[model samples]
Target: MKDLKEQKTEPVQMARSDLLLSLVKASVSGDKNAVRTAVEGIIADEKGKQHRVLAERLTRALHTNGNGTRAMNQMAHDTGIRGREFLAELTPRHQLSDMVLADQTRKTVDQLIEEQQRASLLRSHGLDPRHRIMLVGPPGNGKTSLAEAIAEALAVPFFVIRYEALIGSYLGETANRLKRVFDYVRTTPCVVFFDEFDAVGKERGDTHETGEIKRVVSSLLMHVDELPSYAVIIAASNHAELLDRAVWRRFQLRLPLPAPTEKELAVFFDRHIQNFDGKPGIAPATLAKRLGPISYAEAEEFILDVRRREVLSMLETPLKTIFADQIKAWEDRAKPMGQEESAR
Candidate 1:
């Protein structure tokens, strides 16, 4: 009787201690939701922190599913967490919404939902409009990240298909590989993202060098046209001008992800600098002013990198040298495309 009483009291004390510690850790880590969820789960349980119990059950479920990443997702699904919510959790937190632009050319989650609804209505009425979208944009403008975010929003598996992986270096092998890829998608409900889609679907021309590209494009067209009604396909490219006409027809939705504007860059800079310990004289306005013509990713990196250089400088050395190096790195990478064009 004495032993059991002691054991019961021990857990209550431990739970309170852990709860306080977890709250502090979550705050320090900037994981507010996690802290809230943990507190709520403890209150609901009305006993101890359920971390070990949940972890054990999760491990058992993984064993049942062959212990793979897919198994973990399946476990999440089995536990009543929606697949889309799970995917969203898998995405990096910073690029969730603030980084994305609200504009006509780009598609928002709201717009994608509307488009899907319309596409469904048309298909029900026997007008099979393709939901296969193509996003064209420059590198580092968040093309691939946007694709993943969309899938995360939709709560579906975002499977990225490398073009090189699909195209074999042999006669008729490309088509065979494509068939296998399409076949896998048929079995899995996933958002299929084809990055560098131009490599496989570029338009053909009079040149003899276009033969291989032509054949691959034809195979792509056939597969896309035959894709079942439920699948969502997203193909991305930096070279939109090169996409074949036939392939364009297969994509009823065309979303162009443009570079971030000055305002968006400012938002990115502020959010990133929040975590940095900097008394650097550069105010947000001054940093934003210096970030003219730079993309959001560039701006975020610039602030954090400069802050890091500032914080890590030797106590004896002048800070100007470190600041100069940061500016030099940014200028080297941020030279406008007009310079490259003029040099040519």
Candidate 2:
């Protein structure tokens, strides 16, 4: 046994906090060689403990981040959307309220990091990691907002693939236009966000569908398969089933975003209700009961719309009365069926 003076740090036994501290030290130093050396040291010392796995993970992370940077740089040169402008472009159109994150989209940003690490691993290993992800759910949910959040989380370029720019009427032209996008992904190590994926990657089975879509799909698949691990391709479609199976397969991970629950709605309203001057006649619990099947996006819009109506009201009225009609309509729509159904 080793003497008290020569203590052994168990790699496998290391706490998550310790492992993360090791990683932070590695990342902050900005030296891959140093990170690699530190990881190696940890692995060597804690060969039988929890630290070994943590070291291995940290090594992979550093490698992926480095490779992702290279791929993003190449992509920038290819697409001409790099540097400060690219960062600015990636910023969200609307800022996310901290309350909203807590209320509705908990752990979303964390999930994106996991996704990015997966993407980076694929790249480091010379495999095409489908970073192209789409969030599909009802409108007024935080799909687009989540996209921005992902960009911020990864600290990479985020570009909104303008649908109009890619959709063209000319024959064979649309596919060619899409090539520019794939080229951008190849050049930039960033997230290419397609807000409404269905609009672009529509079903190719229809008779009215031109061969152009088929070609576009083919091009997209080819590029998707060829994407280096560092690039992320995220597409959000309300109708995911409509996407081609091949397209679906290309994405390494598919997260199904669902509507907010009553608890979530209560949290959502609790945060935003403060904006109103007077008491909101409807309680949060009541609002939550009414916001059934409401997506994160809808919840936000509803709050904003309510505020707008109250502020713009012509007559001086109690806050509750000012928004009485809308509240009633919501309540009527949300009336309980008062029945229990078994599993379908």
Candidate 3:
């Protein structure tokens, strides 16, 4: 009986080993699709439960890379109304670590990315991963950047919904455009970002809105509800209060990104200075204190402006003097009273 049992198990073990070996070879050759196929075969064989878990992780990684890189390549091939008219696909070059966010915000974003990476494992256990996120904040406060970072972290295509193309002048045309955008994203794993979300997601009962806008809102609600779990949906709004009440409930995660704090500003300046040159002539803490209540985008622009001036002048001026002059100019432009004075 023992010999018969051993004989039956030997072939199954050998097949599993062969499949794993093939997976390794595929990985070594950078054939992500082949690696996924091998992992799928192992999952199908069900010879070792522990091996299945590892295989699932490997399969997910390969799928992410294969889909992401190939989708980027195929973006040019999509010549239809959905591709050319209503949506623009992008490949994000920024990662989460590249941005300077608050500790809590950083943790939340990290958790969201981790959940996406483990989405397959969650689905295997009958759990749904959080894919729908609502980003609410003032303009230039990193809402769009966060969306881009999410795409990079997931290794997925980033699709931005263009309201100009989506909001049609004719009756019912906008809904048709919306459907096309949804249909395009449904075919792949992507981060579909709706910047200036208030345009379409405004409160349905607002008296100022037209009947067509109302219909669009209803259609949007239905589509949001029906979006697949594999596709990530991110909607960013400068005025969260303008969004429909129903819209708020549809998102699985809601994050409010405020302007950079003093500490974050210091970190941002330090990072930019380090990247520009190995040494910093002016302390980042001093600059951070001087640039009060600036957005993350503004800080980046300021750094770039300083770098540009330095390069243009061939380092003839002292770095401290240049930085101080730039800060004073920025402060004058940012202040309403200073603008009024300058006009006179």
Off by over 4 Å in 2: 1-90, 93-109, 114-130, 203-208, 274-278, 291-293, 309-326, 329-344
**Full-model lDDT for every candidate:** 0.61, 0.62, 0.77
Candidate 2: tens digits of C-alpha lDDT, residues 144-163: 77777777666666778767
Report the C-alpha lDDT of model 1 over 127-229, residue by residue, as the tens digit.
4334578888887777777777767665555676755455678887776667667644543335777888887888776264557667777887988876654
Tens-place lDDT per residue, model 3, 1-344, is: 99999876665466556667878999899996575456555553441244556655544443454545544323322422344467788878677887888778788888888877665455445455688999999989899899999998877778898877788899998877787677556545678999999899999899999989889889998888866666789999999989999999999889989887898899888877777543445789888988788998899899888888878878787777778789889877777766676788
C-alpha TM-scores of all predictions: 0.59, 0.60, 0.73
Task: Please estimate how well model 1 matches the true structure, expressed as its whole-model Cα lDDT.
Answer: 0.61
Q: Which residue pairs of candidate 3 clash?
A: none
Candidate 1 backbone collisions, by pair: 84-155
- The local lDDT score (0 to 100) that residue 233 gets in candidate 1 is 85
Sorting all predicted structures by lDDT, with the top scorer first, yields 3, 2, 1
The CA-based lDDT of model 3 is what? 0.77
